[model samples]
Target chain A: MKTVYKKPECIGNKKPNSYCPGCMHSIVVRLVAEVLEELNVVNSSVMFAGVGCDGNGAFGYLDIDTVISPHGRALAVASAYKRCNPENVVFTYQGDGDLIAIGCAETMHAANRGENVTVIFVNNAQYGMTGGQMAPTTLAGMKTTTTPYGRDPKADGAPMHVCEILDTLDNPTFLARGTCTDPKNIIQTKKYIKQAFQNQLEGKGFSLGEIVSACPSNWGLSPLKSIDFINEKMLPEYPLGIVRDR
Target chain B: MEKVFMKGCEAVAEAAMRAGCRYYAGYPITPQNQVPEYISRKMPKLGGVFMQGESEVASINMIYGAAVGGTRSMITSSSCGLSLMSETIGWLISAELPVVIANFQRGGPGIGDIGPTQQDYFQATKAHSNGGGRMLVMSPGSLQEAIDAVFEAFEKANKYRTPVYIQLDGISGGMMESVMMPDAISDEEVAALKQKAKEEWAVGKMEGRERREIVGGADSGLPLQTLNQKLEAKYLEMEKNEVKYENYLMEDAEYVITAYGIGSRFARAAVNILREEGYKVGMIRPINIYPFPFEAYDAIDYSKVKGILSTEMSIPAQFIHDVQIAVKGRAPVYNYSTSGGVILDAVEIANHAREMMK
Candidate 1:
């Protein structure tokens, strides 16, 4: 008789999931929930879900107060969530498309306004849930499904640098970039998440982290290859480092 | 009773105190900034708290958060700020969170000047704001009414467990006037009201947190997750029972005017002039716009009244539509609207009403 590795009990095990193999969403959920459980704030925490595979399933998985918003409006919902319930631990997890595209107004305003909330922006370069559409962070000459002609450098602007953009905002207290493609990076990414969350909990205003993650299904590569892609390619464009630490 | 010669803003703070509101969160904005300044100085002395939030959008959300925690709370802003707050206002309405939002409206398509205007009637009464929804709209004419309306807005808000607006502006908010403060609501009264408010409007905070029947040893730790079903049923009841209006001189008039707040005050003066000029005119002032006073029309002397006039400061007019529906072709609804900081004066209002008489 042998026992295989078990998923964290904190994650809601609701049958089969829609995410691709080696997706980091389950781990991320477990990590955050563990932090919340450790803080004894699982019941009091309210998270706004973005418009992605990771975003939509939050309400079902978290067993806590949750709100789902239109693509890119996570910051706006989180702003309201934090505003109305300042005592509660409120945060948002947005995708690259969700943060940089339709939600840009909300994101900029939420940051510039210095709202007391944390934004965990998952930048996978391409839209993952919608099957590899070009996102704001899509690399120059990157071949997303929408950019099949290999993302013409002229037509597609360079992969957006969001952490730097947010860092420039005077109001935000902390801004960092991290990845979860490997074990070493995972520890650092978790540290960034904790700091971002602490910024809100301390009532120090907005904090964000631009997470450089891999999308194997969308990247036209195997899970391990995409993980390598993040370490090798995405890091150069995004450059994993603290843009603003306060 | 405190006798204070105060601006509309000061009166609101005093009224908020009298009504049992102990928490205030807002930012500084023209025509309404006085509210935050007033609270900042007053709240601490009264054993309450106030936060000058970062923006109008953030300010309203803070109101949402504090109210959910069972603190009597409010947020105040003008038009530009209110537009920023529209998204969260919808959520508060959806969540049926009891909060008082004071709208000291200003002119705007954008940066449209920070004078006075009643341009929010449509935005308030449209039954939809952020992607289309509803809010309880209340307008106050006099400085006294501004105070009273806020107090009533809180009571009504907590009663129905919904957000209520005390819509004021340059005409109603900026003017200097003397108001004898209404008797301060006793501590016992506020406590009793708060208890009733919790029972009526508050959804418990956590699972097994509903103390509806539990006797003692309340779990102070977990707030209940007041669920989807219970809120839906509560919302339906609110929609049915939460409308208030003030009807004047409709008993023997030949033409009645539909109005509210400053407009209603102007219409009252207009009716007096109309009566002297040998034409009978009366005015209907709706206290609550969403649960509109459809019943007021039921009680109106429709035989005497032939038409109605709807006056507001916003151009792509909003309240006139409600007037049309409430009258239902029994009397044609006429529109008298202007934008860009135009406050309809007594003479202008009288003329508008007199023209409809002819």
Candidate 2:
């Protein structure tokens, strides 16, 4: 058999991943690195890692230059970086809690202004880094530490569909929702990640790929069960597909 | 260039632009609104960015981002706005990013008024942030010094790889005075400076160099103690080299009045009044509030001094604490203050100093 599927050189191969097993953060980070390498922008790319398990993953895992933004402020930072250094490609890697909860205004404003940057938003339905408290994206009936009795739609509010929200914004050049569970879906997610980055590289303003991810340890399930949870429960609510493209 | 009459807020903003600041982000607030307004009109013409952030919180973070990207970035705000930015300021200090901020202070514990007050001295010098982060806090007393301070703030910020704060009261911010502008720094100069700094320290591709990991606070991968020790050592160095003050007319004086910024201006007037009346009085005006002119206090000739008087535009006199500590009981310290946006009365301070002499 011909040797194929070698790791991207942009990956920090010597270090062990700090993410829990079944977490999609490592997979998403690798895909981003691979896309940057493919586009020949790995050297020019800068990643703003927002505070979360995924945020911490960037420093040791991604060989590219990385800045860990204060929780929920990655987009604001990425916006500044892109405006200041227009030649460099900028992107933000953020989780559900970081992007939506404390950082809601930053997310909305960056998208509204059509800043030239990519946002790889990991929606894991809970605050994975801070030990799985309830998040803005936590499912309507899911049981989180804060929502131990299951999220009540009346008391709490519905799960936010990030792609749908960004679709309403006129300036965003591309918006897609993807999930990584089965092999086929993983490939599809990588494609969306590539396109979002291509948007930034092409000077297409404001692109975001919302990856419906899994937090196995936080969800109190085995790695396999988490995959099933994403497929059965998350797919119906989030509905993986492109919500906007121009 | 001939001196031009300019508002203190606008002068500081123009000075920052001349000093090669390419990015400015701020929100509209009292006593410092001219800063953002001036930048909004000027930055586009300068081929720079001026973003009115959603709030002071967002503005400081935007500066953080710009600073991390190795641009000369700054933010301007008043007391309440600065209070909102304190968290990001601490993070900037911890991350060791170079950024400049101007706090054109208004009267406040909360929304006091849109006028000059020295109420934020303690907040600026003592409790800037939660993690024991120290900023190079420079307080400018004149429009010329305000412009000069803005220029020097960037140099000090980039030199130390830390945030440098230019603390001006509303008087220095809102008052109009003639200022001689510095030579404009060319766009090419700014770009070259940013490129050089980026190559040396910014978060970017390693190329052939070792990977750079930018961190702040206790999270820079070093043990907590080691990181703190490093920060402490840096602060000690700042204290030694960065102590700045103006010893105004202290020679052969029987009484010394201590103040900073607008308060200093008033105190100087008070000193002049007492001197004309044949009472020996002088003023010690601290230009840098952080490594505050403690040595300037020690340099005072105690044999001729009757008592040290602290004059300020704050209710309970915040700057007096530092004066008392610096004097170390060699002379009693008296406080005369006018607060809540009420400008300090020079004659009242003069009378107080005369009484102390008696």
Candidate with maximal TM-score: 2
| Candidate 1 segments exceeding 4 Å error | A1-6, A13-18, A37-54, A65-91, A97-119, A127-136, A144-176, A191-210, A241-246, B17-29, B40-71, B108-115, B182-236, B314-317, B332-338, B352-358
lDDT of 1 at A90: 78
Report the error of model 2 at residue A70, Å.
1.0
Residues B1-358 of candidate 2: C-alpha lDDT, one tens digit per residue: 4588999889998899999999999999988889899999999899899998888878888998898879999999999998988888888988888899888888888988887788898889988878778989999889999888888899999888889998888888878998899888888999898888789988665578655556555553567688778778888999999999988888887888888887888888988898888987888998999988789989888877879899888887888999999999998899889888889888888888878887
lDDT score of residue B152 within candidate 1: 81
User: Residue A177 in candidate 2 has what lDDT?
Assistant: 92
What is the total number of backbone clashes in candidate 2?
0
lDDT of each residue in B1-358, candidate 1, tens digit only: 7778998887887789778887787778888767788888988777666776556665665566555445677888888888877777876766666888888888877879986777777766774355344566777778887887887888878776778887888666677788878877777776666456545543223444322211001111223333334445665675688767887777787788777777677777877877887877777888767667888877766676788888877778777877888788886889887778876666887788777777
* Cα lDDT over the full model 1: 0.72
DockQ for candidate 2 = 0.65
Q: Which regions in candidate 2 have their CA more than 4 angstroms from the true location?
A: B218-221
Each candidate: chain B TM-score: 0.85, 0.97
Over the stretch A83-194, how does candidate 2's per-residue lDDT look in tens digits? 9888888999999888988989899889999999999999999999789898889899899999999999889988988888878888999999998897898899999999
- What shift in Å separates residue B198 of candidate 2 from its native position after superposition? 1.5
